[model samples]
Target: MTLTGVTVQGRLNLSQQHLAHGLLFRDCHFDDGVDLRGAVCEELIQFVGCELNDLHADNIIARKGFSVVDCQLRRVSFASAQITEDLRLSKSRLSHEVDHVALHGPNMVIEKSLRLDETWITGEVRIPFSHVGQDLDLRSAHLDNGAGLALDATSVIVGGQLRGDDGFTARGEIRLCWGRMSSISFRAAELHKPGGVALRADSIHVSLGCYLDQGLTASGTVRLVGAQIDGELACTASTFTSASGAAIEAERLVAKDVYLDRGFRADGVVRLVGAQLARQLTCTGGHFENPAGDALDLTGITCTGSVYLNQDPQHEQCFHAHGRVQMCGASIGESLVCSSGLFEFPGGVALDADGLNAVGDVRLNQGFRAVGRVRLSRATIGRQLDCGASSFVSTENPALDLTGLVGHGDVLLTSGFRAAGQVRMRDADVSRDVDLSTAHLEGTGTKVFDAFGLRVGGTFTFQLAQPPKAEVDVRFADVRRLNDSPSSWPTRQTSMEGLTYQSVSNIPCSGRIEILQGTKAFSLQPYRQLGKVYREASKTKEEREVLIAGLRDYRNRGKLKWPQRMWNLFLEHTVGYGYRLWRPFVIALALVVLNFPIYHTAEHHNLMESVGAKESQEHHNVKHCPTDFPCFNPLAYSIQLFIPVSNLHEVDKWVPDATRGWWSTFLLGWTWLMIIIGWLLAAALGAGLSQAVRRQ
Candidate 1:
C-alpha cells in the first residue's frame, strides 16, 4: 500500500497484522501516530517526508529493511524489533518534548547497517542491548538531550564499524558501555557535556581500532575505562576539555597502540592508569593542561613499544604539559622518550615516572625541561637513561630524583643539563656509566647531588660545569671508576664517606687530598680509599703521601686523647708514620756528635775521673792513663757513652765525678742522661732497620 499526500485523523494501528507488501508513506501527516506492534512485513517498510507524533514498532519484524528517511517525528520506538536489512533514518528530525528519549531501540537487531546520517534528535536516543550486523553510521548527526544521555548504546554490538565522524555532535553524554564493535571512529565529532561525561565507552570492545582523532572535540570527560581495543586507540589532533575532572579516563584499557599526539590537547587530566597497550603510546606535540593536578597520568600502564612524549619534528612542537605528567609503575617495553618536551608543575612533581620499568632507553634529554621535580625513583631501565641537556627546576623539592633506580645501561645527565634543586639518586644501581658531565645542579636542601648507596658498574663522570654550591653526598656509593675534575668538587659539605671506587681520573695527589679534606666530616675510609686507589696503581710515593696526609689529618681533626695525640705526632715526625725508615738513623748520628763536646768539657773541669781510679780521685785525661783500665781518651769515652752496646771500656776508666764542684754536679747528671739517651736511640735505630728489612 502506498499513501501520497494523505492525512490520517486517528491512530493507524497495525498491531498483530501480517502484510505481504511493504507500506510506503510519502508526504503523509498523521494526527496521532502509526503503530506496527507485532506486525510482520515481507518487504521494505518506508517512510519518506512523513510527519507523525510517534512510530511505535514494538516487536515488529521487517524481512527486507526499515527506513524513516527525511521524516519529522516527536518519538520513535522500535523496541524488540528485528530488521533483516538496513535500518535507515537519514536526514530525520526526532523531537520528543514530553519524553526523555526521542528514539528508543532496546533489543533491536539489524541485519545490515543502521545509518542515521544528517539526523537531528532533541531527546535521548536510547539504543541499549541493540545488535547491528554491519556499520552503525551516525555521520553529520546532531544529538541534544540537554544534560542527559544523548546516545546510550550500552551492550550494543556492531559487527562492522561504528562511525560518528564528520560533523557529528552530541550535546549530552554518548555512552557505549559494554558495547562491542569491530571499529569505532569519531573523527571531527563534537561531544559536549561541560562538566559531565561526554563519551563513556567503558568496557567497550573494538576489534579493529578506535579513532577519536582528526579534529575531534570532547568538552567533558571521555571515559574509556576497561575498554579493550584490538588495534590502535588514536586521538591524534583531538581535543578533550574537562574543567573539573579527567578529560580522558582510560583506566585498565587494553589497546594495541595509543596516539594522543600531533596537536592533541587535553584541558584536564588524561588518566590512563593501569592501561595496557600492545604497542607504543605516542603523545608527541600534545598539550595537556591541568595546572592544579596531574595532566597526564599513566600509572601502572604497560606498553609493549616505546612511549613518545617528545617534540614532533614536522611541526616543531613538543609535548607540553602544564601539570604533572605521571607515569608511575608503568612498564614500557621500549624507550620512554620526552625529548624537547616541557613539563611544568612548579613546586610539585612535573614528570613522575617512579617505579617505571622500561626495556629500552629513557631519553629525557635534548632540551627537555621540567619546571618541577622529575622523579624516577625505583625505575628500572634496560638501556641508557639519557637526560643530557635536560633542565629540571624545582625550588621546594629535589629537581631530579632517581632513587632506587636500576639501569642496565648508562645514565647520562650530561651536556648542559641543569637541575635547580637537589638531584637524588640514592640507592640507584646502574650497570654502566653515570655521566653528569657539564651538568649544573643547584640544591634547595643541604645536599646538591645525593647519590648515597648508589652502585655504578662503569665510570661515574662527575665533571660538572661548575662546583656545586651545596653539599654533595655520595656516601656508601660504590663506583667502578670516577671521572671528575678537582675544580668540580664541592669545596665544603661533601659526604663521600664509605664511597668506594676502583679508580679515579688522573689528578694530582694534592687535588685528591683536597677532596678528602673537603668532606663534611673526617672519616678514615675516604683516606683509606684514596690510598687503596694509589696502591692499586702501584704509585708507592703517592700512596705514602696520601697515608701521611691521612695520619696528620686524623691527628688534627679526629677526636683523640692527649697521649694519643702526642704519640701520633711523634710517629709522624720521626718516621713519617713508618714510611720514612732512615729518619731514626740521622737523629742517632746527630746525638752522638753533640755528646762528644760534653765529655771533653767535663774532663777539662776535673769533673771526670777513671772508674778504676775513683779511689785516687784523679781526673781522667789523655795524660793520666791508667795501665789496668782502657785509655782515658775523651773521644773514646764519648763514643762508649753514646753507643749502648760499645765495648770501648772508656766509660769504665773515666766517669763524671759529682763531688768536685757545683759544675761537677751538673756534669755528673749529664753523663747519666747520655747513657739513657744512648739506649733509646739504639732502640729507635733497630726499629727503623727492622721496618726496612720487613718491607724488603
Candidate 2:
C-alpha cells in the first residue's frame, strides 16, 4: 500500500496487527505516535519524507526491511524489535531535544544492517545491548548532543564491520565501550568533545582489526584502554591534538600489531604504558610533539616482534618526538632499530630505556644524532649494539651512558662514532668483541671511555682515530685479547693499571713494556697479569721470559739510580733474563778471568802451596817444602776459588797465610762472592732449561 499525503488522527494503533502487503508513506503524518507494538509486518515498511511525532515499535516484527529516507522524526523506539532485512535511515533527521535519548533501541536485533547515511541526530542515539548481524554503518552521519554523548552503543555486538567513516562528525563523545565486533573503522572521521573524551571504546574485543586511520581527527582524548584486538589496531594518517591530556591513551591494550604511521601526528601524550602487543608497535613517519612532557611513554611493554620507532625504509620516515620517549623495562623480541634518524630531546635525554631486554641487535647507527644524553643503562641485548656513525653531544656529562649494559654479540663503537661527553659502560659484559677502532671520543671530565670492570670474550680493539688524542681509562677490564700495537698503544694518556687480559701473546714485547710503563711504578701486578695469561695458555717459557723481562725493565728504567741499573744488568747478562741456558757459563768464565790476579798472590806464602805440595815439610818424615815446584799457576788457583761445586785444582792444599793479612783477606772475600753467584746462576739456568723442555 502506497499512501501519499495522509494523516492519522489520535494514534495509528497497529498493535497486534498483521500486515500482509508492503506499506509506503509519502508526505504522511501521524498525530500521536505510530504504534507498531506487537505488530508483524510481512514485507517492506518504508516512510519516504514522512513526519512522525513518536514511533513506538516495541516487540514489532518486520520480515523484509524498513527505511525512512529523507524523513523527520521527533522521537523513536525499537525495543525488542526484530528486523529480518536492512534498517536504513538515509538523509533523515532525528531530534528529541526535550527527551533524554533521541532514538533508543536497547534490545533490537537486525539480521542484515543498520545504516544511517547522511542522517542528522540531535540527541543521544543509543543502541545498548543490541545485535546487528551484518553491519552498523553510519557513514556521513552528523550527531550533536550539546554536552552529552552523541552515540552510546555500549555492550553491543556486531557480526560484521562497524564503521562511522567518511565525514562522520560527533560533537560529543562517541562511546562504544566494552563492545564486541568483527572490526571498527572510522576513516576521515572528526570527533570533538570539549572537556571530555572524544572516543571511548575501552575493552572493545575486535576479531579482525580496528582502524582509525586516514585523516581521522580528534580534539579530545581518544582512549581504547584494555581493548583486545586480534588483528592490527592501526591509526595511519590520523591527526590527534589534545592539549590538555593524552591524545591516545591505550594502556594495557592487547593487539596483534599496533601502527600509528604515515603522517600520524599526536600533539599530546600517547600513553601506551603496560600494553602487551604480539607484534610491532610501529610509528614511522609519525610526529609526536609534547615538548613540555613525555610524548610517548611505553613503560613495561612486552612485544613479541620489534618495537620499531625507526622501521621506515623511505627517507625522512622518522618518528619525531620533541619531548621524552621513555620505555622503561621494555622487553622486545627483536631489535630496537633507530638507525639513520634524528631524535632530538633538547634539554633532557631523548631515549631512556633502562632494563631493556632485547633478543636481537639494538642498532642506532648511520647518521643518528642526539643533542641530549641517551642512557640505556642495565640493558641486556642479545645481539650487538651497533652505534657506528652516530653522534651524541652533551658537554656536561656522559652523552651515551650505557652503564652495566651487556651485549652478547659484538659492540661496534667504531667507524667514526663520536661522543662529546663520556661514554660510560662500567661493569658491562660483552660476550663478543667491543671494537672502538677509528672512533672519536672526547671526555669532558676524567676519561672518555669509563669501561671499568668490563669483560669481553673476544679481542677489544682500541685502534684510535686519525689525529688521536682520546684518553681512555679501562681500569679493570677482563678481555681475551687486545688488538693494540706498541706505537699506537697510547695516543694520549690511557690508564690500564689493573686492566686484565688473557696472557700477553701475539703483542710485541715493546708494547707489553709500554703498557707496564703506563703504571709508572714498580708494582709486580702487571707482570703477574701478563704471566698468568701465558701460563694458562701453556706457554711456560714465555711466562718466565715475561716475568724476568718485567723485572729487568723495572730495575733498569731511566728513573732508577745507577746501583739499580747495575743490579739489573748483572741479572740480565748472568741469567739471560732467566731463560738462557748458556748465559751462566759465559758469566762464570768472565768472573774467573776477572778474579785471576786476586788469588795469584796467595801462592807466595803458605797460602801459596802448589798442587801436591805439602804445607809442612821436615825432611821426608821431617818434611821439607818441595823446593822446585812447578811454577805456581794463578789461572789454576783462580779456577779453584771460582768453581765452588768442582774440585778443579789443588787450591785447598794452600792455606790462607795471616802473615800477609790483606792478601789473605782478599782471597777469602773472593771465595765468598764466588759461592753466592755460583748457586744463584746455576739455579736460574736449571729452571730455564727445565721449563723449555717441558713446554716442548
Candidate 3:
C-alpha cells in the first residue's frame, strides 16, 4: 500500500496487524500519530518526506527494514522491536520538546546496520540495551538536547564500528556506558556541553580501537573510567576544554597504545591515574593548561613501551604545560623522554615523577625548562638520567629533587643547565658518573646542591662555570673519583664531612688544603685522606708540607685547653711535627757556640777556681791547671756541660769561684742553666729522629 500527498485528520492505529506487503508513504501528513504495536510486516516499511506527530512501533517485527528518510517527526519509538534488515533514519528532523525524547529504541534488535547519517535530533535519543549486528553509523548527525543527554546508548552492543565522525555534532552529554562495540570513532566531531559531561563512556569495551582525533573538539569533560580498548586510544589533534573540572578522566583504563600528541590540547586536568598501556604513551607537541591544578596526572600508570612527552620533530613544537605533570609511581618498560618540553607551575611542583621505575633512560635534557620543582625522589632508572641543557627555577622549594634515587647509568646535569633553587640528590645511588660540569645553581639562602649520603660508582664532576651562590652539602657521600675546580667550590658554606673518594683530579697540594680549610665544620678525615693520596703518589715533599699544615691548622682551629695548646706549639716549633728532621740538631749547635764565649770570659776575669784546691784559692785557668785532671780549658768545660752522658772529667776540675765576687755567682747560675738546656735538646733530637725513621 502506497500513499502520496495525502492528509489524515484522525489517528491511524494499526495495532496487532499482520501485513505481507510493504507500506510506503511519501509527502504525507498525519495530525495525530501512527501506532504499530505488535504488528508484523513481511516487507519494507518506508516513510519518505513525511511529517508526523509521533510514530510508536513497540514490539513490532519488520522482516525487511524500517526507513524514515528526510522526515520531520515529534517523537519516534521502536521499543523492543526486532528488525531483520537495516534501520535507516537519514536526513530526518526529530524534535520532541515536551517529552524530551525524540527517538526511544530500548531493547531493540537489528540484524543489520543502523544508519542515522545527516539526521537532526533536538531531544534525547535513548537506545539502552539495543543490539546491532553491523555498523551503528551517526556520520554528519546533529544531536541537540540542550544541557541534557543527547545520546544514551548504555549497554548497547555493536558488532561493527560505532562511528560518529565527519561533521558529527552533539550539544549535550553522549553516554556509552558499559557498551560493547567493535570500534569507536569520533573523528572531526564536535561535542559541546559546557561545564558538564560531554562524553561518558565508563566501562565501555572496544574490540579494535577508539579514535577521538583529527579536529575533534569537546567543550566539557570526556570521561572513560575503566574503559578497555584492545587497540590504541588515539586523540591526536583533538581539543578538550573544561571550565572547572578535568578535561579527560581515564582512570584504570586499559589500552594497547595512547596518543594524546601532535596538537592535542586540554584546558583542564587530563587524569589517567592507574591506567595500563600495553605500548607507548606519546604526547609529543601537546599543550595542557590547568593553572590552579594538575594539568596531566598519570599516577600509578604502567606502560610497556617508552613514554614520549617531548617536542615534535616535524613541526618544532614543544610539549607545553601550565600546571603540574604528575607521574608518581608510574612504571615504564622503556625510556621517558621529555626533552624540549616546557612545564610551568610557579612555586609548586612542575613535573613530579616520584617513585617512578623506568627500564630505560629518562631524558629531561635538551632545552627542557621547568618554572617550579621537578621531583623524582626515590625513582629507579635503569639507564642514564640526562638533564643536560635544562633550566629549572623554583623560589620556594628545590628545583630538582632526586633524593633516594637509584640509577644504573650516568646522571648528567652538565651542558648549560641552570637551576635557581636548591638541587637535592641526597642518598642517591648511581652506577656511573654524575657530571655537573658547566652547570649553574643558585640558591635562596639555603644549600645549593645537597647530596648527603650519596654513592656514586664513577667520577663526580663539579667543574661548574662559577661557584654556587649558597652552601653545598655532600656529607657522607662516597664517590669513586672527584673531579672539581677550585673556582667552582662553594665559597660561602660547605659541608663535606665523611665524604670519601678514591682519587682526586690534578690540583695543587696547597689548593687541596684550602678546600679542607674552607669547610664549615672541621673534620680530620679530609686531611688524612689528602696526605694518603700524596703518599701513594710518592710525593714526599708535598706530603710533609700537607701534614705540617694540617697540624698547624688543627692547633689553631681545634678546641683544646691551654696546656694542650702549649704542648702542640712546642712540638711544631721544635720539629715541624716531626717532618723537619734537621731542626733540633741546628738548635743544639747554636746553643754550644754561644755558651763557649761566656765560659772563656769567666776564666779571664779569674772567676774560675779548681774544685780540688778550693781552700787554697787557686784559679781554674790554663796557668793553674791541675796535673791529676785534664787541663782546666774553658772550651773543654763548655763542651762537657753540653754532653749529658759524657765520660770527660772537665766538670770535676773546673768550678765557678762564688767566693770571689757577684760576677762569679752569676757565672755559676749560668752553668747550671746550660746543663738543663742540653738535656732538653738531647731528648727533643732523639724523638725527632725516631719519628722521621718510622715515617720512612
Candidate 3, 1-696: lDDT as tens digits: 999988988788987899799999999999897888889999999999999999999999999999999999999999999999998999999987732999999999999998999999999999999999999989999999999999999999999999999999999999999999999999999999999999999999999999999999999999999999999999999999999799999999999999999999999999999999999999999999999989999999999999999999999989999999999999999999999999999989999999999999999999999999999999999999999999999986689999999999999999999999999999999999999999998776678899999999999999887888788898899999999988776653878888888788999988988887887777777777677777887888878878877777788777878887887787788877788757766776677688788877887787776666545544446566644546666777877776788847777767888998888898889888888876766666677777678766
Ranking by TM-score: 1, 3, 2
Alpha carbon RMSD to native, model 1: 2.6
Which is the winner by lDDT between candidate 1 and candidate 2?
1
- For candidate 2, the C-alpha RMSD (Å) to the true structure equals 5.6
List model 1 lDDT by residue over 1-696, tens digit each.
899999999999998899899899999999999999899999999999999999999899999999999999999999999999998999999988522989989999999999999999999999999999999999999999988999989999999999999899999999999999999999999999999999999999999999999999999999999999999999999999998899999999999999999999999999999999998999999999999999999999999999999999999989999999989999999999899999999989999998999999999999999999899999999999999998889987678899999999999999998998999999999999999999898774888899999999999999999888888999999999999888677776888989999999988999999888877888888888888898899998998899789888899889999988986787676767678866766775676678678767766666676665655655445556655656666677767765888888777667666788778788778778878766765665565556557645
Instruction: In candidate 2, list every pair of residues with a backbone clash.
Output: 503-533, 603-608, 617-623, 617-624, 618-622, 618-623, 618-624, 619-622, 619-623, 619-624
lDDT of each: 0.89, 0.79, 0.90
lDDT of 2 by residue, 1-696 (tens): 999999888888888899999999898988886888888999998998888888888888999988888988887788888999988888888877822688888888999998888999888888888899999988999988876888889998999999889899888888889899999998999888856789999999999999899999988889999999999998998998886889999999999899888789898889888899998988877788888888888888889998777636765676677777888899999988777656667768877888999999888888777767788899999999998988887765678888999889989987899888778888989999888878877655666777888889998887757433455667788898878645434444565657888644477654676667664335566677887787888877767777777777677544778876775676667665556667878877888888676655454444543335555643221123456443446677566654667764445544444455776677666666776777777766766666557645
Give, for candidate 2, the lowest lDDT window spanning 10 residues.
Answer: 617-626
Q: Which candidate is the best by TM-score?
A: 1
Clashes of each: 2, 10, 0
